[model samples]
Target: MKNWIIIFIVSALVGFGAGYFIFQDKEEADGTNQTTTQEKESKQENVVKEESKDSNAPKTATTSDGGIFSEKGCISCHSVSALNIQGGATGPDLSKAYDNVEGKHGKPIKEFLKVPTSAVMSGVIEGNPLTDEEIEKIVEALKKAAEK
Candidate 1:
């Protein structure tokens, strides 16, 4: 009888200790989530203010970086922080992507941007092709960013 009681007490203590460890992480995660949400809200507010500054501005793509990229809709899927632009995460950052990246059809960045063989990019280019002037600017921008 005494041994059984000792075993039950030990088990209860172990269970309580395990429960404490598990529940503690959940509380920390909730706090972290709250902080993340607050950060996102703040960022959204800044974006709203920027947009409100130009109410008469043309509604372009998903992002408004106020450059050739935004005008050409590249900012919808790509961002070049080196060019001080913020865009969607659906595509890779083009900051230093001179020749380091490729297209779905195995073409380099320049070729891909010029022709856009990828199914997604094919449709995009079909709707709005990149002009030679715009392509020159983007390629030069990428080269400069990569050099840095």
Candidate 2:
């Protein structure tokens, strides 16, 4: 009886410790999630403010950082008309990319903006697919199109 009681006590202690650790980890994860959400919300607010400031401004065919598609040979796969340099249509029609990235298909605009070429192959042609600047410009262009 004494042995059984000691075993039961040990088991209860172990379970309690496990439960406490699990809940503690869960609380930490929840706090991290909250922090990330707040950061994203702040970033979105900034983007909205910038967009509103430029709403009345003319829609420049180029992003705030010039025409990256043309400069980076993206026009080979995509076309913006004015910056014509047509090539293969291996990729989807990018002219209407704004529609896809927006909530038109239930995808958050920010999520879509974060990864413009997510649908595209990770590596095509050469090893390097896209530079950070190129990706940023693409996201910016998408944002501009979404605003329109």
Candidates in order have lDDT scores of 0.67, 0.52
User: lDDT by residue for model 1 over 1-148, one digit each (tens)?
Assistant: 9999999999999999999988776654445434563565466556645865796743322333335666565665887776566667788888767767563357777788878766777766775778888777777777866766
Native-to-model Cα distance after best TM-score fit, residue 43 in candidate 1, in Å: 18
- Regions of candidate 1 where Cα sits further than 4 Å from its true position: 1-66, 102-105
- Model 2 scores what on Cα lDDT? 0.52
What is the lDDT, from 0 to 100, of the residue 47 in candidate 1?
Answer: 60
Q: Give the TM-scores of the predictions, in the order they appear.
A: 0.51, 0.36
Give the per-residue lDDT of model 2 (tens digit) for 75-120. 4455443222232466654555656645454555444434334535
In angstroms, the error of model 2 at 110 is 8.1
Best by lDDT, which number? Answer: 1
